[model samples]
Target: MNPSDAYLAHMDAIVREKVRSIESARAPEQEHYLGQAELWQRVADHVERYRDELSFIVRDLHANPELAFEETRSAEVLATTLERQGFVVKRGAHSLPTALRAEWQSVDFDPRRHRTIAVLAEYDALPGIGHACGHNIIAAAGVGGFLGAAGIGSGKIVFLGTPAEEGHTGKEYMIRAGMLDDIDAAVMVHPFNYDLSAHTWIGRRTLKVVFKGIAAHASMQPYMGRNALDAANLVYQGIGLLRQQMPPSDRIHAVIDEGGHRASIIPERAEMSIYVRSLYVDTLMDLSTRIDDILTGAALMAGVEVERSWDTHPMSLPVRNNTTLADRWAQTQAARGREVLPFGVLPDSQAASTDFGNVSQLVPGIHPTIKVAPPGVALHTKEFADYAATDAAVTAAIDAAVGLGQVIVDTLCDDHLMNKARSEFENAGGPIRATDLR
Candidate 1:
């Protein structure tokens, strides 16, 4: 039988009550050192002036969606736009053909005294679900953000176009190729059902387990042959049992890719693909080890040889949001008449991972969510894809761009805020070696 919708209704009710309670309380004010009302007004005005152009970009991308690592047209549109705005554009940056790196600096820019901020853009679509994740909105917002910050400050701004965020880790690869080497901080926004200051994004690792056994005709010599499908079934059941012992913040899911072809023949080979997730990096690693043990046990019980391979793509780390930067984002959104809720105010039980998490671990960053759809609309769905093409999504994209631009302005001008952001990153274990995750 299918699951009941009662749980969904109950959770929705609980979230509504919690949101009301949180909104009633007054939020603490964030202090500004160098940024003023005029700077924010200027940025907003710049983004507002190009509203039509940004909307066109969003609609164009949504209309012509491209999958990960194949976003040639999408990348070309973004790159051409940035280049027209006087930004030096480089296609195929950091060894990725579809990636981009565009930069603009004020005349007084100095590496010694000023900071460099990156505004990241993602434009990759999912398989058979064009722009369901709203990456088209991301691409447009990032472009608008960079345009707003252009020629405004004495620091530099980079518009980075990252590709393939669906199942592959594009940011991680760019980082390995020196993408974040000179970047002081990074900021971006994602489209979601609600406006959030900091949403929960967990760590993820993919594993592929293969079982090998002798094949024989079941009716002729079934007892003489070992069944690899039996071992695969044992592993699947073992993982289901493991779920009960797992922590509430951890998640595991698996699928059998190969099994016996016919009942009369014992299968020679079988395989299963699994995804393991956890709220923390250490816990994610521990969970992977436990899962490996389960696979080994299943192989031993079924008398089959097992082969385990992990992370055909790069693993995504959990996001460590810098509090100082996130506070500035909240202040910006509030100025636009949107009350951005804090992290814990929303339910985090249903969470996903992002390549941005890896970017945050390497540099202090913020990946807030901007409201584009209703509360009941979830991401990566046909319904959400429909919403992504609407006029409301264009509005959210503009707001997100203004918010990110303001944050970049604040980080470049305010020494106190930058110092605090760096300190917060250090306190949370700064500059993780992504290669050491294994």
Candidate 2:
């Protein structure tokens, strides 16, 4: 049964009261090398000048939605747009055909001393709900931010087009391909129900299990058959029961891909696909061990041979949002009249996973969210998809561009801020390799 209307209303009222009572704290005071007011004005001017073009990019990507690594035309459009702004654009970058790398640097740029900030973009859509996660807005905002930051011509800026975020870790792939080797920091904005500077995006790993057993006729000599389907069913039920013992941040779900061919005969083979998620890396690893035990126990109980496959693609680590950069992002958004909430203002129950988590482990980064829809409109839905193309989304995209651009400028120009960010990253167990987690 669905939640009662009265219950939902009461919860909404409570949420509203909480939101009203909480005031987002401002970032600590810090002076930048460049004049903040002048740089911010320049960023805002760029957004105003290219507002229409940014909107066009958003609508075009929304109209021509592509899935995962198949975003060929989408990559081309973004690369060409960046090229028009005098950036050196490379399509098919970082070992992915749909990925792009566009860069602009000052005359005196140096990889050894000068900092390089990457503005990440994800443009992949879901299977049936295209742009429902607001990747089109992400692409536009990233392009706009890169362009605005490039106009300053004080430091290096890279606009990275990362694909396959819907169900694949394209950013992780790019990272493995040395995408962040020389990059100092990264920033990106996601379209969400609220402007949040640091939200929980947990780790996720996929598991595939196949069971093989002896088959026999259901009506005749059924006792001789070892049903793989039964094992699969047990695994599902075991996971359901395991949920009660799991941490609130931990999530596990599975689907049986092959249960049986017919109800009459005992199934000889069964297959299941599962997803395990958690907010912490250690917790995710621990949960993975427990899940493996469950799969093994199910196979043993049914006397079926089982084969397991982990991470059909790449696994996504929980995002470690860089507060140093996030605070600057929040301040930038504040200048644009958007109160970017610090972490914990909203409930973490709405948390999801992102490939950028892997990117954060490699370099200091911030993945803030720009509000494009109402509070109740969840992502990955038709309602959110509809909102992703609205005027509100366009405005939010512009604001995100301005905010990201300012953050990049601040990181590049302010040596103190960058050092603090790097120190913070080191203090939080710096430079984790995603593969090592496995």
Residue runs of model 2 more than 4 Å from their true location after superposition: 1-34
> lDDT tens string, model 1, 152-191?
8789998999999988989999999999999999999999
Report the C-alpha lDDT of model 2 over 1-438, residue by residue, as the tens digit.
Answer: 331232243345435434533443543544466587788788889878889889998899999999999999888889888777767788888989999998888888877878899999999999888999999999999999988877684678988999999889999889888899889999999999999888889889999999999899999889999999999999999999988877776789899999889998999999999999987666677788889999999999999999999999889998888877887888888778887776768776898999999998888999999999999999999999999999998999999999988898888788888999999899778988779976
Q: How many residue pairs clash in each candidate?
A: 0, 0
Candidate 2: lDDT over CA atoms? 0.87
Cα deviation in Å at residue 147, candidate 2? 0.5
